[model samples]
Target: MDNYARLKQVWIAVIYLLLLAIIIPWYWPEEDVRQFYGFPIWALLSLSGLFLTSCFTAWVCLGREVTKE
Candidate 1:
């Protein structure tokens, strides 16, 4: 519908995807020992990207305004 609504939908989808990534091992398996900075590679990268993407999306969405203030 509107930019604000579209942004909210994107935000919700991203959050759901992030939750799925956290609960389900998409790239890395349970027995894998590969680590990045002492943390699981998949876990670290997936979460960091998720957080950063969410923040960036929010910031950009905030910048788009239909109302004059």
Candidate 2:
């Protein structure tokens, strides 16, 4: 596989991990962890990192040229 295809696969994996981080908590028993700025710590940190990483990935991907086979 070429670089573009590889990068797309990696991006999809990152998105899958992000979704897992967002949803896996629902199956766990509730516990009160220390809040970050009045929001759940996981939501604040995990989602912020996910969004930033996604933005950076998109920015980098925009400049790449995918050659046809």
Candidate 3:
């Protein structure tokens, strides 16, 4: 993959992390809603999103190579 495309992926990773970080902290502590499998519902959802996004990013970054035109 070209360096430019790789750089874009780094930006994407940063954006995703920033978004998740902002949202998880903002939403997790509100209302004290019950726990799912030992975690608040919001926390669980955030965690799931993080995990899935990681898997997807790895799949996109490693499973396929981007070529410059």
Pick the TM-score winner.
Answer: 3
Residue 39 accuracy (lDDT) in model 3: 76
Candidate number that wins on TM-score, 1 or 2:
1
lDDT of 1 by residue, 2-67 (tens): 998998879878876776666456667678888888888777877777777677668766877688
Q: Worst 10-residue stretch by lDDT in candidate 2?
A: 20-29
Candidate 3: residue 10 Cα off by (Å) = 14
Ordering by TM-score: 3, 1, 2
Whole-model Cα lDDT of every candidate shown, in order: 0.74, 0.71, 0.74
- Residue-level lDDT tens digits of model 3 in 1-69: 999979988988787777577446674556687887787777777777778777767866797767799
Q: How accurate locally is residue 9 in candidate 1, as Cα lDDT from 0 to 100?
A: 79
Candidate 1: regions farther than 4 A off: 1-24
Better of 2 and 3 by lDDT: 3
TM-score per candidate, chains pooled: 0.47, 0.45, 0.49
Q: What lDDT is reached at residue 13 by model 1?
A: 82
Q: Which pairs clash (backbone N, Cα, C closer than 3 Å) in model 3?
A: none
lDDT of 1 at 7: 88
Q: Which parts of model 3 have CA positions greater than 4 angstroms off?
A: 1-29, 66-69
Better of 1 and 2 by lDDT: 1
- Residue pairs with clashing backbones, model 1: none
